[model samples]
Target chain A: MLLESTEQVSRWHERRAAFAELDPSMRAEALQRQANSIRRDIVRMISAAGQGHIGGDFSVTDVLTVLFNVVLDVDPHEPRRDGRDIFILSKGHCAAALYATLASAGFFSPNELATFMKPLSDLNGHPANTKVPGVETSTGPLGHGLPVAVGAALGSRIKGAPARVVVVTGDGEMQEGSNWEALMSASHLGLDNLTLFIDRNRLQQGARTEETNALDPLDEKLAAFGLEVRVIDGHDFRQLEAAFGPSTTGKPVAIVANTIKGKGVSFIEDRVEWHHKVPSTEQVEMALEELAQ
Target chain B: MSTLLDTAPVDNRVAFAEELIELASHDDRIVAVCNDSVGSSNLVAFRERFPDRLVNVGIAEQNMVGVGAGLAAVGLIPFVCAAGPFLTGRALEQIKADVAYSQQNVILCGMSPGMAYGELGPTHHSVEDFSWLRALPGLDIVVPADAAQTRIALRQAVAEPRPTYIRIGRHKVPPVSPETNVLERGRFALAREGSDATIIAAGTEVSKALEAAEILAGRGVSVRVLNAVYIAPLDQQAIAAAARDTRAIVTAEEANVAGGLGAAVAAVVAELPKSQRVPMRILGLRDFAPTGSTDFLLDHFGLNAAGLVRAVEEVLNGD
Candidate 1:
């Protein structure tokens, strides 16, 4: 049987402690308001840039919000702290959500969000670890993040540290053969400290993932590769927070977060053409209005 | 001719393995990663001593390289050992992406490189290792001439914090470098100095080039022989000096003539002032070697001492 640490038990206890400091009915309201603010920030940033992967940005917003707000053991002020949990965005095209989430968590100043993708800006189209304080590795190529995450997780394990490694990859990007190789090795090494979260938005560059090359039965595939599988609603903050709980088994965990492309926005949600389509001025106003409520 | 020599003939692979073991003993973080070829790579001793540190990925070259990158990511200095053909040919993309582009500090050990597996056919021969690897940036390619140079090169690679490829030959070679010679990157060794012509060679060709120099000296044709251990960052100073002083230059290696030592030397010589430039001849594998013994294959490919002398004479005559 896996034993839960005293520190972890106390952290679980602090969840209630934080709630006790708030009014009984205000706790849920506070979290909902914070989530809505993060979504609004994501919409505003992507709309101003006029060029971003708004689909994945919206789909993964709540997941990132929950991780930054509640789940992860990270110190935004000290991003390079040795004991901090590493969060790697393998689906790097979703820079808007990551930038907003990072800024909201104070990894960098919130004012820097205005410079995303400008000429000579440190915030390029994709997140670069050399430029961003909280980014762990530079990733845009598919199938690169899991291997690197495996390395960081293995490093934490070798050093006997309690830090966990979380990597988020796209559903379509799993077609690269290197991901399976990493999966097998991570499972064989029994890296229980590692967690892979698949952003199953179901849309790739050109077409729907099923119309391209299907990655359905993703849970079975990951389980076959020896990872303990957890299917969750990616946009649900409560589900994401629960899935981010400490692993009870001494094996790597794979959370297949089912999400819709362009989630939260009315017209673009679940639309295949919106994988990287930037919203126009009118669309941006509509999105901001929807998110403001 | 039959006088007794005190030293025994040693294969460079043994030297490579022994040096690696010594380095690992001092640094516990040094790990050996192989594609199920521990015996062929002479890593039996390493596996026996440190069983936990040896990661045998079992016949998957791609996975072997990726795992090496993973190990490097975690602060372990991994020496990925495998046959030359499989290591470079089978997993070229992995080498390019994971090791070179990712800038992972993993030592890629190509065992039995460059047609050393004679009669094993084209599939087994690694004649394209140099051409394939030289194209990739941020990787140091070192083909040691003999045991001493191999040891020095291995030690230097371990101490340096970068990606490197060490080509270890299966064929036996006579020790050329003096025991006092320290190996440094982009530094060439002048085995003998002459003014008539310069013979630039690496790997097994270095000894043959020296032998050819002795033959040319007998005929009063003074020749300069240079042993090029580091191929990528070619010693520009030494190569430039050879071009300036020598009447002509002859480059030889156990790889294709397209992008190997010959192409590298040609690139350097082409950039020099026309008046200072010398006539050149690149003697190496222009095509795949026919199935035969290693000795016959070398002779067939014009890689022996006699072939080197003729090429030097031909280049000297401007033919």
Candidate 2:
């Protein structure tokens, strides 16, 4: 059952308190387990809906889990609180992963997950900020989130609020000139409160990112734009936590999170066709079994 | 209608900037976001008055719009301003997804819209803004007729917690309506009242439309004139009434005939109970304009008083 009402948002505090009791290694392990469950939910969500970007979901699941469970100072109840940290999913194709993570984080009722992409459901293919709690902005088109995050960070600075704005984009998604445009402004304005995580899963819709449009030397490119760059294993919770940690100097942080397109399911891992291809019933069962292990 | 008042030409951007600064004075949450368009957008005074509140995102329009959305997300009212072409053409997707689709309370000010760029050519002219923005859902597109209306539009957009786009004119225009005219959302004021025919005009074309009305009045053909500032949530009541009471309705705009005010008014008049509908004529640019001044282009496209009178006469004669 999902925590439905605003009053039950204290569930976040309880989860935080419980996680605080655990040691560092245990905390990482606990987050890993949470991510594993969320991954299972992603599979079920897309499978039931008969359509989704499952590969990107599996790739970004660990990052979303870490952000919501560990780093972000947000309450599902007061999602619009002036001081709460804001998260934007720029690679909106991975809405399944974001929805599963928000549901797991007690932003809304988990039961609502079953209604995703259905007629009149709040959980569309792209997350809408107005419909879904904890969703700061609606994004389906690529390369929009980072610029908005820059503005949000600026807003926080103007208000003297300590809120941090974080955004996640895809590796293929970086080829869009808008992201670079935002990168320039983000650095020029010195938005230390903004952080960007690129889900560098190597593959795009039909081919490898390099084959489609080269994004290698990604860190150098980001550093050239004056951002503090860090390359980390996207699937590893420890590295994610550290990368999402303190800023380097007064510049914005960019994490080129290296990841496989499909991290958990062995059969589908790194295969270009699985970018948005749904698994067969038998394949679903097999993927579920692999996840169970 | 015989007596005419001489009014000085005023840049709507001045009123827009002044009103914005006035609003920002009391409300610190209001921030001005522009893409290196401070001088053109008339935000120099605003920036000087409140340095921290003015966010110049450089020449990145896409980033400017997205950043405006981001600012609104965290409870700041960002008035995103830029040259009309770049603001609408370069960053249309950001405006769609970040501001409109996400329901961010960001005010997008399209500075120097229509053929206001004059000799700069079609590349700089934002003649397609109306057609492009009218199709987007959850966006209130306002094209203020003159300086006072521009001030009202800015104030209304800031007060209302929703996404709105205002086309602030760089071209100077004389006041077409009284200063006491109550500028409501989606409502138009009657600039001149005549039951014989009605000329519906918006933005910079409004003053010219009134001049056309005066020209028709010289021939003893009375014409009603409506200043259509609110384009998206158009005043259907006024449009329907015009169709019912007037012998003909001629719509004019400094935009394209494809989907601007002409198209909007036609759509309304088409669905109105058939008997009440009158003969209609739409006037606007049909193609990319030739290299010339704003006035030259307006004359070349047949969008001035003479062109409007010709259209109204044609509609009247045809019917």
Candidate 3:
């Protein structure tokens, strides 16, 4: 029932190749279906484990889908290949979503999803780069990913490598001043190769981002920090694709991905209490059914 | 490793920068990152020679450390230089998560460590770096005794890439360690050998401990001195042997007595075979220092040669 390590690697490569070679017209639908399937996997994994941030996972699923299915140029066998585009999940609390995406995209076996946060699991609560493939850097603490992205971008530039770096952070996580510091550095270095996505789900752990700490005029604030800011509906494939393109402003790009927490299921979406709450058995069935539809 | 024949006192920061520049010149993967501490970290010449390689991330310590980790993630060996207080105190979480837990190939160069920032007071003093960094697993903490050790430590870090922190002291220190003995990881160098008493020291305090040993030798109290190179992976063999062979011991460091070279040696000594209850003394700054120079601060807190001699004598005679 379990594939060997080499078999698992090849399986992911085949899956990734299939999706990567899909027809241009069918790209959006394929990404949506993959995202929907990954969502179901996340719901099951967290429900079985009884511990996870399912709300943020639901909110940030689409961008991750587009990244793995479309934007990024990475290989499961050679995750750290020279001149490969790097992607990091700065809001690492939603690791279930990342694991699901990586599994579906063929980085590893989908069977590994059962081991999420289980005993001796490589899938830690936060994304650890050393343990996980396709994770460029370990990021769990707020404001960590942007600086790393800046550094990677600079490294690529200095080495004459055309590799690009893309990092996603939670809107609630942006209140950390370190992100601003990194923004300053990225702008100073003129890292056009770096792209930052702020999952603007508007909800933090306890309450709303505005109620806890206001990040109003988020786009303007990013612009002030010398980034090329773009606001888009986070779940829209077309908009995400447009915003995720190469930076024309010759500055670091920042996309405020306006989204609703717990986006897919009707009951969970826009609710504050579902930030990390596990659904009961009945709720799990309902959520999965809703995601399937 | 280059041989050191100069007996004149030298600042380890100078050697650190020179060694970094030399290493970076040959290896294009080697880069430097700082938080607007280029001047303070003595990286002016490095920045000049390799302008494109020195990444100045303004005055942000957390970002500086995270950037260092990121660069290392991309296969570039980064020597992240910053003032010791800010690098260790401000960006501790980054150091813990990014470098230590993740095991990034980062060489964190903590410049001007300990009371080297003397008159700036406790706000700028990094006396707690040992205790703070020692708690993190997989992060190697090295405190080189002099200029030669500083250069060797840098080369060793590059030779065997891992998450490491090296303390580059600002205080001027005379060379005490010779070039003959290999710089082994987690092993203390025998600075002076004797059988009557032992003094364990690191960083700027190694020279002071040697001076104290000479005075103790004149008083008919032969003293053994150990330069504690690796603070985290402590040389337990040397520490246990010293405690077993010597009548008394004194641990000195340019750090707090609470948790540093002294605390590390004590922890090792506590695990020794139960028969040897060696009387000991830990000489370091016990409280926040007053307005003074580095020498004044060391003498004020009883960390000078005379103070170390007195502490060793008391431990030897009291037992």
Model 3 bad stretches (over 4 Å): A1-25, B1-6
1 or 3, greater by lDDT = 3
> Which scores higher on TM-score, 1 or 3?
3
Error of 3 at B35 (Å): 1.6
Ranking by TM-score: 2, 3, 1
lDDT of 2 by residue, A45-129 (tens): 8889999999999899999988987899888876787799989999999999998888776789778889988898889999888
What lDDT is reached at residue A33 by model 2? 79
DockQ of each: 0.26, 0.91, 0.73
Docking class of 3: medium
- Candidate 1 per-residue C-alpha lDDT over B1-319 given as tens digits, one digit per residue, 9 for 90 to 100: 0111124445799999999999989987688888889999999999999886787767767767866776676567889999999999987877876677667788999999888888997788888888889999888899898898888888887788588888998888877777668977878888779999999999989888988988899898999989889997779889899999888999999988989998999999999999878889998898878998777889998999999999998898864
lDDT: which candidate is best?
A: 2
Residue B262 error, candidate 1, Å: 2.1
Model 1 residue B266 distance off true place after TM-score fit, in angstroms: 1.7
Worst 10 residues of 3 chain A by lDDT: A1-10
lDDT of 3 by residue, A1-293 (tens): 12224675665566557767777556667777878888999999999899999899999999998888778887776777888888889998999999888877656678888988899888888888778887877778888888788788888888888578999999999999999999999898899999999999999999999999999999999999999999999998878878989999999999999998998899999899999999999999999899894
DockQ comparison, 2 vs 3, better candidate: 2
> Which numbered prediction scores highest in DockQ against the true structure?
2
True contacts kept of each: 0.12, 0.97, 0.64
Inter-residue clash pairs, candidate 3? A12-A106
